[model samples]
Target: MAELFQIAGAGDPRLRDYTDLRDVSLRKLLETERGLYIAEGEKVVRRAVEAGHRPRSLLLAPRWMESLADVLEATDAPCYVLDEKTIEQVTGFHVHRGALAAMERPEPLSPETVLASARRVLVAEDLVDHTNIGAVMRNVAALGFDAVLLSPRCADPLYRRSVKVAMGAVFSLPYARIEDWYAAPDLLREHGFTSYAMSLAADSVPLDAIEIAPGERVAVIVGSEGPGLTEHWQQAADHRVTIPMAAGIDSLNVAASTAIACWHFRPR
Candidate 1:
């Protein structure tokens, strides 16, 4: 059974976890310090619960009760039932999804654990844009990719925008951060993975040109939006792959590039 409360004002202290959602810096600091992440919409809320994340509390309009009754029943967390207007005022945005939950952030898995069963992995280095990060995750999950590895400076995949843009893909995909940036190339080689750095270098191979034997392990590395892979990381790859462009267009955005790479490099 879940405890239900009524919230009439956005200023209510009980809604602290849902406040200032539009303030990125504030939300990042608050969510990190408090070990909580916001799960919005009924589907995302359910996915978060399904992924074994604990709920500290839930904020939703009355309409979502029936749809999420099972999830609420499973948690003893307080459920703050508010109207749509109150939700908007509290969250600093329109709560079009009609539901949101404050979920406890799960402990991050190590690089080794995430890679144990992964054959075709996407490695992100310093991809700080939350939308791009989520889009990549969505594509990776939809494609046949096995897992994802993030560099130390990557953005939070659990961030609200990331979660929303991913449409719950983040809950299903396995991922971890790599602490040792310089040693990653050797580590991938040791694990029998051919690390291909996605780049535009003149000597880079076309996306479909890479040769992979049956069941050979592979890892594709993508870099940040503003800057592509650093010189050191670029040189660290077993090979470099480039998605050729037409009409004098030099390159695509990070998210698009990742999607094409994921599609082209999908397990064969």
Candidate 2:
């Protein structure tokens, strides 16, 4: 059973975990230091719990309590009930979904661990946008990729914006950061995976033209939104691939291109 408390004001110390959410730098520091991440919306909260993340506390509007009753019953975490206005003041956002939970951030999986059982993977290099990271994760998962690997500089997939944008898909996908960004290609190759760099380099071939043998492990690499893949990655990857575009259109958004590539290279 959960303990319910009525929060009458926004300045309550107990609400510290939910404060200044819109301040990305502050929230990143606070969340990382506290080993917690905020899950917004009723569905996201439920998904977080379902994915084995323990809740440190829950902030909910009075009207949402009934709908999340079952979730509350399953945990003894403190539940702070407040009106939407105060909730907004505390969070620095409207929080229209009416439900938010501070969940314990799980231990990150090692790159080797993430690749151990994955036959199809998506590799993101220096993708700093949280929304793009979330969208890429969702695309990888939906298109049947087994896992994801992020370069050290990639944005945190568990960031609030990322989580909300992913609609909780982050919880279901297995991903890890590569400490040695330069050796990423070697790492995948060692695991019996052939890496295909998604690039617009002159020598790159259309993605649809690439052929995969049955049971061939594959990794589709995408880079940051602006520069695309780094020159090193473009050269180090086993193959440079491109999604052929119409005249004047050179490339697609990182997430959109990833979806197309993942679908094309998905396991047969």
Highest lDDT model number: 2
Q: Each candidate: what lDDT?
A: 0.92, 0.95
**Per-residue error at 267 for model 2, in Å?**
1.6
**For residue 76, what is the lDDT in candidate 1?**
95
Model 1 residue 247 CA deviation (Å) reads: 3.4
**Least lDDT summed over 10 consecutive residues: which range in candidate 2?**
242-251
Q: Residue 137: error of model 2 in Å?
A: 0.7
Q: Which candidate leads the pack in TM-score? A: 2
What is the per-residue lDDT of model 2 for residues 150-218, given as tens digits with 9 covering 90 to 100? 999999999999998888999989999999998898999999999999998878998889999998999
Model 1, 1-268: lDDT tens per residue?
Answer: 7899998798999999999899999999999999999999999999999988899999989999999999999999999999998899999998899899999998988888888888999999999999999999999999889889998899999999999999988888999989998898887888889999999888999988877879889899998888799888799998999988896886799989999988877886
